[model samples]
Target: MIDTKELIDSGDLELYVCGALPANRAQEIAQISKQHPEVLEEIISIENAYQRLAAGLAPDHNDETYAKLEAIIGAKNKVVKSPSSWSPYIGWAAAGLLLIASGYFYNANNETNEEIVQIEQQKEFLETENIEIESINSQYASTLQVLSDPETVKVNLAGQAGFESSNAVAFYNNEKNVTYIDIQGLPEVPENMVYQLWSLTLDPLTPTSLGTLPIEKESYNELLRIDNAYDTQAFGITLEEAGGADAPTLERLYTLGVIDKG
Candidate 1:
């Protein structure tokens, strides 16, 4: 009700009980506490705490000793502590010690919170790095499987008529109907042009488009997989307009390799 916890934590309740709050503010708190159950409980709790502190700290008030001290002090040249003089010093000392201890704990708590935040950030960063490394390892394991399989056919596609310097290797798994093309040996395609692969049937000399190659390529050494299951007599690549052509552009054929079905 009206955030009793907030009011208590704000030290307003303590100030009210100690009479440290101004008269108008204290009266306002009293009025609010009368209307709110939680606020009333909190005010009672603060009053109880104040009573306990006051009981422990209140100086022993002995009227007979104070009367004797007053009599001694009245005789101008006598030494006597009137209790009032020493009580103020004791209260100030206690307050100073409490302030120092509170300051130390406040600084320690802030530093501990900062360290916890820093540790959490480091944990997140390490977890992200570990995930990336695991992903890379899984990729390497799959690549090894493809390279190690005897059924995996490695076809070397050499440079064609005009492009004598370019070459690429095609790894095909007929059982899986998958092909991983290694295009590292091939040069970069010109802007607005793309490399297209074809599954060719030499008897009919038909060239069926497999797909367009990625222009902004990854590391050339990495193989790019394609899902193709054609009974290809030959694998050929051609440079075509960016999105690739419906048929192979023979004039721009860059590489060709025949699969000897012996």
Candidate 2:
């Protein structure tokens, strides 16, 4: 027979009883108990002894004792059923909902403020662009006045016989010592060539070079500023070489005018 105390302390017997031992170890122990009947008898005897000892140590509980315990449990359940015990939980739930609403409102307000700031910035930018446009309009108005003044002498350069319908006007201001020419009616010059203006003195038929007109489709329609003042009798324009003209090319004169520089 195996000592029960020694077998339990071996750890192997405890693992075997708990079904935690390896299959090989369990088979070995089973084979030994089968071959030695004394080991199996001792195992059965130890189990029966433990069961009997547990039954003897338990305290006796009568029906009257159980009834009293059940009554106490039923009373505790009645207290838990009262509504006042649940008030704190309800308060916490309401507080959670309010916090969520406040968070949503705060985010929405921030988004609205951001949109307003962007609109204000756009308005400011548009206003600045408007001011620049207005300033440019004012400058153009002042320049137009200088070209249309009555005291300014007007010279109409009519197209020559071969080049009919090509006309231009020159506004000369003697006091300002400047001439503004409107070459809108003139045709485009051939490549590598430009239009040149001249002041002609009728007595000796002298031609003096004024200046070359800048080339572009709309430049001819705009007012041109000329440098020199004149007491000339006529104004003339011709298609000359680009840059400027040296004297006047009479054969290439496209338009001419008799100016009454009074």
Among all candidates shown, the one with the greatest TM-score: 1
Compute the lDDT for candidate 2.
0.73
Candidate 1: TM-score? 0.60
| Candidate 2 residue-wise lDDT, 150-194, digit = tens | 767888889987778678888877777778888877877788999
Q: Local distance difference test, per candidate?
A: 0.79, 0.73
For 96-183, candidate 1 gives per-residue lDDT tens digits of 7577657656666666676677677779999999999999899878877876787678888999898998888888777777778888
List the candidate 1 regions with Cα displacement exceeding 4 Å.
1-94
**Would you estimate the TM-scores of all the predictions?**
0.60, 0.50
- Which pairs clash inside model 2? none
